[model samples]
Target: MKVLVKLIFLLTMTTPAFAQADFKTEQLKFDRVSAAYEEKWNSLQEALRSAGIGRPFKLYMAAYKAEGKLELWLKTNGQKTHQLFRTYNFCAQSGILGPKVKEGDLQTPEGYYYLNVFNPKSSFHLSLGISYPNQVDRFRSGKEKPGGEIYIHGNCVTVGCIPLTDDKIREVYVLAVEAKNAGQDQIPVHIFPFKMTAGNLNTYLKQFPAHRAFWTNLQTGYAYFEKNHMIPVLSEKSGRYLFK
Candidate 1:
């Protein structure tokens, strides 16, 4: 009886320790990423300063699907307008040029979105979730089956998400995390079909007349940002985007 009681005691004692160890391991996974950010912080700060961006600034991102490019824009504290900072090329393309419509459509969404979550332990190495199925997406694609979980992630491969090379995503993710930690909420990510220049629009019309009206609506927001370096307030009406 004494031996059995001792065995039970041992098992009970060891179980909590095992659980604690597992928890620590999980925590360290995130900690490692934090350490990486800290290590690279100075270099990022230097880049920002060189570009006239100050610390703890607001950030905006624009992705051009046709060009395979992602542009980063920044507005320093006390500044009225954002300035272009850097552009990263998407490493892969998926689906086609249009808003994602269904669960299995394999289409990368085109519209306004924001960073919603950060994942350090992403299977794609690291990732930032985009708020897909936004008001416009749900209105256009229907509420019940609009699909979701779009992300800008590392790994250079994608089904319906933006893929950056692992190195590039690490830089982007680190900068975004720093922006979040510094109190910049709602970092905007505007995904465009292309640059939306008149030339580009003409090309789009010739190739994809079916999508011209929708792309035209997107151009209003695109033009506002290009001319003003500020994001316009967005609203939805009847499944279409209206920019103010």
Candidate 2:
């Protein structure tokens, strides 16, 4: 009878601990990241909903390279489902957002990328981190520094991540989290030089004469999407642009 009682006590004591440990592990499996990029996130939701792109969809993150010429993108589905979230600028190095690689090389990447986590307590407000140094990066840089900590965050100053400032991050983060929680795992993001309308194109051409080649490529991508109303893939084969 005493052994039976002791067994029961041990089981009761250990069960709660085991359960708690499991819960902690699960929580760590996918950390609920923070973002100060709230304003930008909110702007995205408002823009999408107001522009008629709402729930039951995915997310896309686009970042312009420092020169304001090139850009990078990320696609995430069901990002609205997360209870917390934010968008990141894949190519941000200094005062603006852009790509970066080697030390002191302040150029944010321009191409396709992915997200790894949500960082709440970011050096800049709230941040959504991006996965840089993908296949292309590895192949190209070889033994070079494969970039680091690219994010969409608050606090606004970036060495390589997109910064929306704390106020802005808060707005964007909330909407992104909601999007994730809605069951999206892969979101699609398209980055362009400008709005890519006739007027905007003209403005860009007139305003920045040095960026003709860069803007031209950006317009091609934008046009593909404009015609299809969907994110189009861009590639070059035998020196010819391929859009699908």
Best lDDT goes to which candidate? Answer: 1
Residues 1-244, candidate 1: write the lDDT tens digits.
9999999999998886566445324533696466656666678888988887877688889999999999988888778899988899999989988888878788899998999978888888888899998777887786458788899998988889999977788778877776665567689999999999989999888988988888999999999988999889988888788876
Model 2, 54-140: lDDT tens digits are 464455555444333222222334332221123334333453222234544654554455556666555664666666655544554
Cα lDDT of candidate 1 equals 0.84
Cα displacement (Å) at residue 243, model 2: 5.3
Candidate 1: where is the Cα deviation over 4 Å?
1-29
Cα deviation in Å at residue 91, candidate 1? 0.7
On TM-score, the candidate that comes out on top is 1
Steric clash count of candidate 2: 61
* TM-score for each candidate, following the candidate numbering: 0.85, 0.55
Write down the worst ten-residue block by lDDT for model 2. Answer: 78-87
Please state every model's RMSD to the true fold in angstroms.
9.8, 9.3
